[model samples]
Target: MASQPEQRSKVARRALLGTALCAGLVATLLTTGPARADHRDDAWTVSAPAAHEPTAHIRLDDTTGTVSLSVTRRGRTVIEPSPVGIVTEQADLSEGLRFLHRKDRLVDERYRAKSGKRLDRRVRMNETRLSFATPTGARLDLVVRASADGVAYRYVLPGGYGAVLGETSAFNLPPDASAWLGAYRVDNEGQFAQYTAATAPTGEYSDQALFETDGGYTLLAESDLTGDYSGARLAHDQGTGTYRIELADDRVQADGPLATPWRAMVTGDLATVTRSTFTDDLAPASKVPDGSWIKPGTVLWTWLAGGREAGQSLAAQKAYVDYAAERNWPYEAVDAGWYFKAGEWDTTDPDWQTNSWMPELVDYARAKGVGIIVWIHQRELDTPEERAQWLPTLERWGVKGVKIDFMDSEAQPMLRWYDAVLAETAAHHLMVDFHGSTLPKGIQRTWPHVMTLEGVAGEEKRTNTAAHLTTLPFTRNVIGSMDFTPGAFQRVGLRPNSDAAEVGLTVAYESGLQMFAGTPESYDRRPLARAYFDQVPAAWDDTRLLTGRPGREAVLARRGGDRWFLGGVYAGAARTAEVPLTVGPGRWLVETVEDGADGLVRNRRVLRGGDTFAVEVVANGGFAGIACRWRPGVTTCHR
Candidate 1:
């Protein structure tokens, strides 16, 4: 029965207790741990239990007070150097720092994720912090926590350090590292391009990029992002195979002390990185205790190829709702132009820009067991004045959420707007899906209702390929939910998919809104396809990327409502692979779908102690999915 203030006080106390624990560990490490004494004379070296992770150590330069990370596997150094920070302060912080104190400890912490495959929400890390200050009074701390599977670190800027111009944190990889940068090309339609550290273009922005080194794989991402800083992009350094932080804005000014976003890396195993909730761990725990209304389910997009008329007219919207309701889909999205006529949205005369059909359409959809979501230009919701009036108005209209698009920037102001909108929408108990925005940096961890984001080269693209499909799991989607706007069974497009491939897209991509980009008429033809989506979930309880080759193949397993839906994509001539799955030991009733050369075919089988299964995909074709359930120990976790 504690108030909010009391809860906050307890959190502060816990943080102090953690700090104390860290200090005690520091002494233990310095005196008794198997640390190289020369590290203090040269660079303070850090490690986590094994040799395969030779390059995963964090190195702190004692003299310069600079921190960088390098990971090695099998004697090969994969990440040579990735600097942690570069703050512009009056006093010298680069060198001549009199070491103040240090902390080292084993950290164990856990919290519940608002919505995700809620497994292993906690992390046990080998933690440490090196506190340093200058005689001129500049003080800072380089704190790092490394686990057997991942590593996260941040720079703590004490309030007295004057103003910070910005950061110079950079990731410098080795030549052999392969990276998948979001939106590598394709005229910004949202698609990822896979490249090597030696080949990725410079000056380009990627939400989060991956480095496949001999040391395993390193998923580099930003976490627990707060403050006035702009979004961080990986600007490639071709010659040195490094990436520097090209912040969206020049500087972030704060009156109080600020801790930069955690520069996190998960390197070791692909599944270890793939299944990580570390980013969510960095964010504060969910605020909503009873989030029953924050529904995560498939929604139909009216603007998917064709629906503008259907989106605007009460009759057409009703038809779409009929389809959605029949399939048990919870919501439908009305994209662009439903609110007001084109070019008249900002008219001082509100009636000129308003649409009269919206109210009736909302009622029609609501009566049919479906909720309505409208799309808005993000710029329209940038201000409190705009949101205060608009949000309440939308709430009154019975809308569930809004898809706000055209962000196109990662500047500090844009970052501020991101939080502001989420806060307002949350207050009104409405959901938000961001588009034309950069990749999500654990924002959903803080605001669960802030569902999916369009930072990847998703299905909305004029064209999408199996290659793009394969690349997503390794790059665009690892940090948080990605709204690819899937389901393109339209039988046309530069990169159209087979019925099976489309099913695979639904399983592969995780979003707050699992939308089938194809129209109802298109899906209706393939009742089997509709049946797959009818039972699939927008979010999952757990996920496993069984086998994949970037731009070549991806096989994945997702659990929903206690059942597992397994899917995969193969862009080449029909070939088969043994897909590994992590299922609890049991007997399972498995229902499968695969490409039947011209279309998709479905069948069922029973599996015992489900581990790995073999399947084939047609050349340039793929397997959509197969539904599986434990016959003995049934668990409807999401129902």
Candidate 2:
């Protein structure tokens, strides 16, 4: 997340990645950057469900005060313990801590998502507790929450500890294990790529580092971050042959009643991990009393149709407003040049008058049924007074949201600043899209108004390849909605995707701010496909991963209202695929827009639960469809 002074450079530095923005402390850690205890035993194992046969085990080693983990599906150990260790200023969890008690319980609950891929969210897990006490009188609770899909554990500081020194939860994988390392060292939001477990880089991280073994897969991520705590990244430990998690900085003083973010590792099939709601399940409930004002919809961006030459002009913006109105798109962005060109950094500047025209544009967009969203550099929102002055004006003008960009740092202070902006914006009933941001750790669950983030190598990266498209759905987008700015129907080299892949991408990405990155003319060329694009909503009632292999191929199903949308995309090879229909028990009418021998074609059929339909995708191509309960006018045959 870049500041106002660096907006230009930040935009120019178009590396990919994004998520919700938070603020707390703002300091940088060393570019290069944890303890040892031994916990290796199968005896400490426990299954996800008490009544079922155990497939995986979490072994706690009291012998050396450490831990080890494994999954039977993979045969060998998945985690060899980068030596189960936790470091702090006044105490080392590894040393002088004795097992005090142990307990286990079954948890089954459900919650609704303020805005998410699914409305009916469920949590089914068997929790295990292991209490430890330090000779220094500091106590810690090691809690593990296990579900059929995966497992997550966190350190609960019961008391008697000093500032956090970080933890040493390194992952030791089997020989054949490979991982999708999202190495943070890669300049910006690092892209995820496959590497042999041992060959994967050490001392780097992608916020959600995904490791796949012959057994299935395990997703390692941090969640539910609260006050005075540091975000963590992985650091490779050569001596231990594992990737140790290092909190952002050195041992900073941590207040009591603190629990480290869940050191979560979910093991399951690719689809299970992809569809897991663990991130949102980890966050605190929404603070907004009434979030009905928050919404998800498609937006039109003028930058695509008008470039730098026409982008900032009143006439070009009006054209975008016209386009949005014509397409029934809900919002239009007045990106980067309404207020000082650099945005409302200091209203005292002579250029402040330039923002006077914003009221007029907002009025025009509103008359056309399109809400306006303006852009501002993160620094412009650094102060409450500044936000009070700026956002109120936008809200008064009936603006729906703001694209706050260039929040280029991830320090604690920066994190706090992000929260401040979100809170301030929510109060005014304006939504947000964070650009030049970090990964989402269920902040959308906490702040429903935060629509999306720019933490993935999305269409904006003119340098991205076809492979980038296949990698994002599993890695960066896994945690939550991202501001990928998808919907490009041009050539792969030009940073757009094939028209065949366009519809799939539209349904594939979940964002409150759903906008395309291509020219209006380019999108207009595919009128048939536009039917799905125009009607599809950004948020969903449910999501289903029918079949997929990260970066290889994916068949996804999502529900919105009574309609179910399906999309299938593949990497570099053409292949036949089958998608199990997830519609309710009743027979449903299905409409498909998929690749045909000559060109893309539309087909209709009737299908029901447990039935699989054939879908064919070309190399670097995709297919899309929609299904819903039978209607009289729509063609449907007996199933």
- lDDT of candidate 1 over 415-480, digit per residue (tens): 778768877888888888888875667777778887878877677666777777787777667788
The TM-score leader among the candidates is: 1
Q: What TM-score would every model get versus the actual structure?
A: 0.86, 0.85
Compared with the true structure, the alpha-carbon lDDT of candidate 2 equals 0.68
lDDT accuracy of residue 216 in candidate 1: 75
Q: Which stretches of candidate 1 lie over 4 Å from their true place?
A: 1-56, 60-65, 72-78, 89-92, 105-107, 160-163, 183-190, 205-207, 346-348, 351-355, 610-612, 627-639
What is the overall TM-score of model 2 with all chains considered together? 0.85
* Per-residue alpha-carbon lDDT of candidate 2 for residues 1-639, written as tens digits (9 for 90 to 100): 422213322332232113211121001101100022222322455466733322446555655645544444435344554345565544556544555556788788777665567767877777777666544444567777767766667777633345665565656666457777776742236666777677765456765777776657778777776445666677653333466666655544566656777766666677777777777777677778898888788887755546554545777788888988998989888776555444333367655535467778888988989888888777777888778778887788788888888776655566668778878899999988888875677788888788888877776666665566766777777778877776666544765345667778877777778877667787777665666677777888888887777767767888888788887777776767677886678778888878777656788887777688887777778877888787667673211
Lowest lDDT block of 10, candidate 1 = 29-38
Model 2 ranges with Cα > 4 A deviation: 1-63, 67-82, 103-108, 158-161, 185-188, 237-241, 308-311, 341-355, 490-492, 576-586, 595-600, 606-611, 630-633, 636-639
